[model samples]
Target chain A: MRFTLADSRLLRESVNIISELVTEVTFKVSKSGIDLLAIDPANVAMVDFKLTPAAFTEFETEKDMDLSVNLENLKAILKRSKPEDTIIVSLDKDKNRLTIDLTGSGKRTFNLSLIDYDREQQKLPNLKFNAKITVPASKLDDAIADMGIVSDSVALIASNTNFTMKAEGNLSDAKVDFPACDDTVISLGKEEEVMAKYAIEYLAKMARGSKLADEVSLSFANDYPLRVEYNVQGKLHLGFVLAPRVSND
Target chain B: MRFTLADSRLLRESVNIISELVTEVTFKVSKSGIDLLAIDPANVAMVDFKLTPAAFTEFETEKDMDLSVNLENLKAILKRSKPEDTIIVSLDKDKNRLTIDLTGSGKRTFNLSLIDYDREQQKLPNLKFNAKITVPASKLDDAIADMGIVSDSVALIASNTNFTMKAEGNLSDAKVDFPACDDTVISLGKEEEVMAKYAIEYLAKMARGSKLADEVSLSFANDYPLRVEYNVQGKLHLGFVLAPRVSND
Candidate 1:
């Protein structure tokens, strides 16, 4: 299997976000593109990532393949890709390794040994969300950052007309409000006022998906796992499902 | 003493560079502005910094004062300064604290407790250099960074015609050459060829002075301490003197 991306930003961005939650993952590659589903070691969150053929200038694979890898190693190599460089990834079956080539002003190639795969990929959870909010990913990132400044856990409250993220500390607190009428608020809906608390650390890591897509959809329910999704049209999709920090808070 | 800089960049940049070398320092403030001379805990390097009255918009002081502070604390406060903000530093003698005021879109004040000081400031070293080479600070910074990738020590070579910085590892080595005719070589002079080695860690920290000034002057002799200096006209000066890593290498 081999693939080349004219711009490695989507690969870099998505991999970076996922690597923050799990150190190792298996990317199931086929003719359609690549897909990966993995749960964090702590079982506090799960990540779902997919890249379609449209994201790559050239993609070729003979058959379905599971390329298990240490994400940190792949992320470190991908970080070396310059804006003008085209990134190529290929499987070296003879050596049981994966090779990354950055081609442009200079061609630098790095080979990373593949890891053994014994665990099953996480299955998709059928979640029934009571509320869904769509807004600019940057807005969500900013809210998470603001909450991080005050506390380790943040409360997300969504209603028919507005969304609010709030965090409190021993001496300080921060809040970000997004009214449905705001230009950046693409959409908002809720069966009732739904509020849930999530660890800011996970939200901060998941918010990094903003680099791949401008708009993000947030789906949640009262004291239930929250799903945050960022999609770049048909090119790629990166999403995370995070367990709430509290129960019926 | 109290002073306000239209842009806090000079203070922020110089202090940040100095903080990397030493954790604690004493700033001598008077009508002339501020002066600081401190030696790192390892005593492998010394940092000398100065900010003339020309760098500040409003300067006022009735008497000279020695303000001893933790560089890390001061750096944390100054890091909050925005480009559009004016930074005002004032001494709160009654409370034995220093107040930093950042005024712009919002007003924020941070008070840092002053440290007790009984030790004398480091005296400037007096040594005549056999050679001196001046080049763009960015070029010098890049050289130092490249050398850092190969080894923990770097050698500096200077002659009447060109300057070179080289570093060698067990398997890899890197060198940067700057000819006298190079556009960025502001000046170069030497009675004879001279070379000296210094710890790259110190050189990397000193190269950060480039943030305050684009041009840097390097002076050293065989097995002698190296002086890296950056000056922003009448605004400020930040420099470091690093001891040789090996004698006559």
Candidate 2:
């Protein structure tokens, strides 16, 4: 299996995001471009990520590799990679080992044994998102931070005129409002009215993951699992699905 | 009163570090340059910071200004400043407040009232360091991180041959390692050896503070306070003197 990326930083960034939610990642590579799907237990959320050949620095894999390994260990090894480095990933089925080679300025390779991770067979419902918006990564990050200042859960609403995140905590109150009244960048197209509440902790983790990716594609339906997708690198996609926060009152 | 920095980030960084130890900061600017001295209560630590006009991006002040305000509040405002922002700090003596205006992509200012803060009178000692090495920031950062992996306190020993950090924990095991073996970039001009144990927690804080500045001047005498001095944006020379932890055994 061989994958090439122009900027090794992009691939590393995508890997960084998906690795956060799942320890083991499954890569489905074919002519239609590469696809990645990751889901945590409970099936309340799932991330479906995709990347076209244009985004890949290089893509030369004919077969698929559903490799699973400890994410924290991989992250530690990846931390040493330089931005200009060319990353080469290879798996030896006979040795049950995954090798990551970083080639650039200096050469470094990390080899780790792969574990038999049972890909969950749970069926993910065909999600019907009422709202979808392509907002900048920094805006979402700032909104999430303001949410953290207020409460453990944040209610997000995306409308035609504005996008708002509101949190009510015990002592402090915080709300991030992005009105289309001024900035021409953020726009809410038709059929974009969706309101949902999610655990601020999970959203925060997702935000951290999103920071490395260019822009996050948010999909949500009222009280349903929210889907966040990251178009990582040119050949990879990382996605996260999080359960909505249930309110008592 | 006016002072400018090559990088606004450096100014923001210096304020971030000074705010951690001292709540209020008194910057006494003179015709010669700028000298800032702050001493925390308990008389255990003091910061003596100085900067000359040549290093300043812009220095236009015929007279001196003894401006004192809450360092944390000032830091909070500086945090919002952009790296390219031209920070303008002024005194509104009639209003009894200090205003910091950051003008870059946008304009923002924070006005904080002056407060009376009692500072300890600390007499800095002139001690000759037996060991001195101008090591890279990355090398020092790595050494501190490695030592922290084993124990809470690390004893630094610098000699002509090597710069070593050794730590012994409550457990039977210990670690002694030098992050950099033999680098020509690291200068050991004086054939000297000095060993002093400092709490890893404080060392880590100092290391973090050192990140804002290029290199820190470390001064120490056995059983005495360890001093770290670094210039920030050539406008602030922040200093830190930490007391040594006494060994119970």
Candidate 3:
């Protein structure tokens, strides 16, 4: 398998988001695109990522294959790349190595050994949600960070008129209200008021995808896992599902 | 003592440079300015910093005083300041605390307790040097960082024609040369060739002052400690003396 990317930033951003949740992942490569579905070790979050051939300047595949990758090692290699660098990735099947070539001011190639893991692939869960909200990615990221200063968990509440993120600690509490008429709220739908508490750490990790897109879509039900999706330049899509924290209150 | 700074960045930068060498420092405050002379625990380096009353927008002092400070604690408080924020510092001598007020979007104050150290003040050594080189601070910083990738110690060589920094490791070696004609070298003065090896870690710490000044003056003898001086905006002067490493060659 061989592929070339015109811009290396998308891959870097995708890997950054994935690394936040899991250290290792398996990539499914086909003629159409590359796909990844991984659940974190704690089983608290799931990541679904896809990059189409259009995302790359060139794409070639002899046959479909699953390759296990260490996200940290890949991130280290990607960190060496410049913004204008073009990246070429090819697999040496016989040698069980992946060769990554970065071309910019100079051309450098890194050979990373492949790892074989005997683990079953995670299947995406089917769930129904009562509320959905689309907002600017930065707004959500800021709210999450701000609320994080007050509490370890944040409550997401969606009503007919507004959506709010609230966090309360022993001495401090923060709340960010997003009304339906606010410019930050692209769309908000709810049949009734739905509220759920989620771990701030997981939400912050998911928010790392904000680097990939200007807007993010969020969907969830009352007391259910939250779903976050970021569409990158119409070519790549990154999604995360985080289990809600079971609160006593 | 009371003082207000138009911008807090200068103080922050000064503390950053000092903290790189010593965790604890003593600040001598008087009507003229604030002064600090500290030697690192390892006795390998010394930092001398002075900020005149001209550097502060408002300066007031009733009497001369020496205050022992924990640099890391002070740095943590400074890191919260925004570029546009005005900082006000006042001493509560009766309470043995220093109150720092940051006024920007909002007003936040932090009161740090003063520590009493029984250590005596360190006297600056009177030494003579045979060579002096003036160069861009960033140029030297880059050269040090680049050479750091190759070895733990670097050799500084100064001749009438050029100044060079070289580092050699077991497998790799790197060298950066700044001839008299190079833009990075403002001036080079030496009657004869002089070379000395110094610990790269200490040099890197001193290079933190590069952020405060465009150019830095380096002076040393054939086998003596190196002196680094950074004059900031003609108002603050930061200097460091680093002991040379004993080399077998």
- DockQ winner among the candidates? 2
Superposed by TM-score, candidate 3 places the C-alpha of residue B121 at a distance from the truth, in angstroms, of: 1.1
lDDT per residue as tens, model 1, A1-249: 889999999999888889999998999999888999999999999999999999999999999998999999999999999999999989899999998999999899999999997796469799988888888887688667756755799988887777888776543345567777654453344356888999999999999888889899899888999999999989999988999988444
Instruction: Report the error of model 3 at residue B34, Å.
Output: 1.1
The DockQ figures for the candidates are 0.04, 0.04, 0.03
Range of the 10 consecutive residues with the lowest summed lDDT in candidate 1 chain A: A182-191
Summed backbone clashes in each candidate are: 0, 5, 0
Q: For candidate 3 chain A, which ten residues in a row score worst on lDDT?
A: A182-191
Clash-forming residue pairs, model 3: none
What TM-score would every model get versus the actual structure?
Answer: 0.54, 0.51, 0.55
For each candidate, the alpha-carbon lDDT, in order, equals 0.84, 0.65, 0.85
How much is the lDDT of residue A129 in candidate 2?
Answer: 76
Instruction: Estimate, for each residue in A138-161, the C-alpha lDDT of model 2 and write its tens digit.
Output: 667756765665468988788877
- Order of quality (lDDT): 3, 1, 2
Tens digit of per-residue lDDT, candidate 3, span A1-249: 899997999999889879989988899999879999999999999999999999999999989999898999999999899988999999998899899999998999998888886588688899788788887887788678766665799999998777888877543345667777645453444356888899999999899888999888888878999999999776999998989887785
Score residue A241 of candidate 3 by CA lDDT: 90
Error in Å for residue B237 of model 2: 20
User: What is the C-alpha lDDT profile of model 2 across B101-202, one tens digit per residue?
Assistant: 556543344455676655554456665655555555555667778778778887766665666678876664345444344331223435456567788876
